[model samples]
Target: MAAADREFSPASSIALTVGSALLWGVAHLATGRRRIGLTLLGSYALLVATILSMVTLVGSDLLTLAVQPGWLTALTFMLLAIAAAWTVVIVWSYVLVRPDSSHPGRRIATIVAAVLCGLVVVPTVYAARLASVSRDVVTSLFTPSSAPIIADDPWNGRPRVNFLLVGADSAPSRPGVRTDSMTVASVDVATGATTLLGLPRNLQNVPMPPGPARQRFPSGFTGEPPYTPGLLNEVFQYAEDYPEVVPGVRKGYRGPTLLKETVGGILGIRIHHYAMVDMAGFAQIIDAMGGVRITIKDPIVYGKYREGLLPSGTRKLSGEQALWYGRSRTDSDDYVRMGRQKCLLNAVAKQADPMTVLNSFESLANATKRAISTDLPQNLLPAMVELAQKIKDTRIRSLNFVPPLISTAYPDYEFIKRKVEQTLADRPVNKTATAPGSRPQSTPQQSPERPLTLDEACA
Candidate 1:
């Protein structure tokens, strides 16, 4: 039979129909006499057959009705067939697991089963509708004529571009909640050089923007604004104190823009784009990918009274564990946590199967829509997917800004100004321009130790 006709194939339909009928017949037979329910069984068999056929064939047709003008219709039908087959398996499992005895519990079980079946169908149907709506919304949001600067120059002269990626623990209208975590990713598209810069939540004072200066205070200070001039760690605590005053505080931190500007100044690179992913969305995407594997370089033990344990070795982590791994910093310092973040990212990158991700695109897209906010254009999605396909896990390199590289120096205003100046000055200079302090040094023997002290590290 042709593929389209296969959806309506009588043999398959009859088998499934009969199977369902036999189950219902057995239920009725257990209640009373078998002979009395023969007619009921026959009627049920016919009803099931008709319903199955209509739902499988007609439902598939209706979904793919406006898929496209050509071969896409067939592809849509095939996808629908797959979805229906899975749904059938789920429903069949429910039918078989149900008890045959006609007790009050059985009645309740039957009602529960029916409700569950409806619940399953409802989401699938709703997801399909949501998918359709999201497709249109995405299409409208991303116009082909207009593209982002990153898309235009994926391999520009700049070796690295910093992106401040934030996960706000709370929304603006609500306060007291602070950002769960803050990450700055520096991407060098040309060489596939990527680094995940993780900032500590409790480091001490980090400067706050001018907006609601009154509300933002350091962690320890009461009545004083939370804003302090110290480490990136203290920012969240300050934001928490007077959450109402800050306009865009998520959790206690201000918006992603603040972090972006802060990191950009430190790194000496202009932030090309910013992407924000919420905790819930992060979990969904990780689960969809069947979890990720990370090789832990150091043993970590920490909890209430330091009870949690993760030995040093390769371990496959579930979404729940991964979240804890990402968020927890009590055992290790912020620098080590930054390493963990990069490790998690690398693990995800290594295990990410394109076909699997493509299949879960609907779920992924839906999850992203609710939890993520990015300045990057939506139109670049297809291109990004294609680029990801071409790049191997080994080709991607992860870096962290720590120790001697980027610091959290005090005299906050002066440090920020100097960092920004250094970044602007550290542009991709032409090889021919032999300027002092710009050219590569001669040898390791002649080079001086460039260790960044705690003061420099903070700067």
Candidate 2:
């Protein structure tokens, strides 16, 4: 009799199909197709091992080496091709082990099994595509569009690592790109404690790096004589205008290096990296997470500088509203605007949880494509991921170098260093959240070193 006409055990047929679903070739091996089964088993094992290694090895340099876009794209397609083959194997296996031709509805049973095989394969294909898209986004945004001017080392031995986060403004009215908002995130490598220092755009006489620029501005950067004194924000654009000052900066990434060095000189510390976001593109990021909730302190106007868009209230603002709220300076000064930016930062830090990110991944990917740019290497991602989780419980402290605390015209660099040092050292041991319904001790003292609470600052 033919194989289809031969008497077959119902249990064995069911087991073969189900077994293939679980291990791709388990049923083949169980049914004594040892050579075919072993080949499949080896392939399955290799794929599983590679995936497990990538996910488990985050926060390590090893993770970076493996997850490059090229590798991920190749792996993604390979898995999909395997899934297609597996679907074929499942259907073929059932054909080989079918019940006798005399069995009732034999054709119907075969069709049902084939349908089931397609169901499993469809989702596997979809998942592979999603992973491919995610890898593409990371590679496009962070793979370094230009050769980086600076090099990075492990912060393992250092007490702290500092990063410059600049909000780049390239308004149509402006001559060139200006760093409208500049902040430094000095983080504790071991503890994950972070200190944020906001620098106002109007800050004057900001120091230059130790180069011809510094020698020229022995009294600090004051632009050129005909132009009069310039503000801190202009430092980057100024250096770009005259690259001769900081000779040998990377061909395309001149602004980041120049700005990073200027801030480092002003604060008197080694800045490890800089990540810049275009202000116009900032709206996309906020919109990706479906806009952010903020406490609107005052009416904010834009463009014509008329017609208020956001009235004072606690409400959810779209990307445009949030950007204006952060950028508005007509009703107030740059210092107050800087305070609002800090409040916005704290709100994002507390609200943008993991679930939100996972659900809105594609939207976030689009936003990142439009708004974000960073010098951070892909290899450092896994390590940063590990560090982020470790410090999830720690409170982030804010310190702005805005007015009343220190003169912007002539900042006390020594005092600024001391505050950064103090925040890093005297940081609360149990900075984690207190138990439910239990009020923590309140501090009667407040200084730039310990900025106002988010609510107070926004108010």
Specify the highest-lDDT model's number. 2
Writing each residue's lDDT as its tens digit, candidate 1 over 243-333 gives 5545565652344455555445444456766766666567677877777776666677644356677677778777766765665677577
Q: Candidate 1: deviation at residue 229, Å?
A: 8.0
Residue 388: error of model 1 in Å? 3.8
Model 2 local distance difference test score: 0.71
How high is the lDDT of residue 177 in model 1?
A: 39
| Residue-level lDDT for 134 in candidate 2 | 71
TM-score of each: 0.50, 0.77
The alpha-carbon deviation from the true structure for residue 61 of candidate 1, after best TM-score superposition, in angstroms, is 28
Q: After superposition, how far is residue 290 of candidate 1 from its true place, in Å?
A: 2.6
Clashes of each: 23, 2
TM-score of 1: 0.50
The Cα local distance difference test for each model comes to: 0.49, 0.71
- Local lDDT at 269 for model 1: 54
Candidate 2 pairs with clashing backbones: 59-382, 59-383
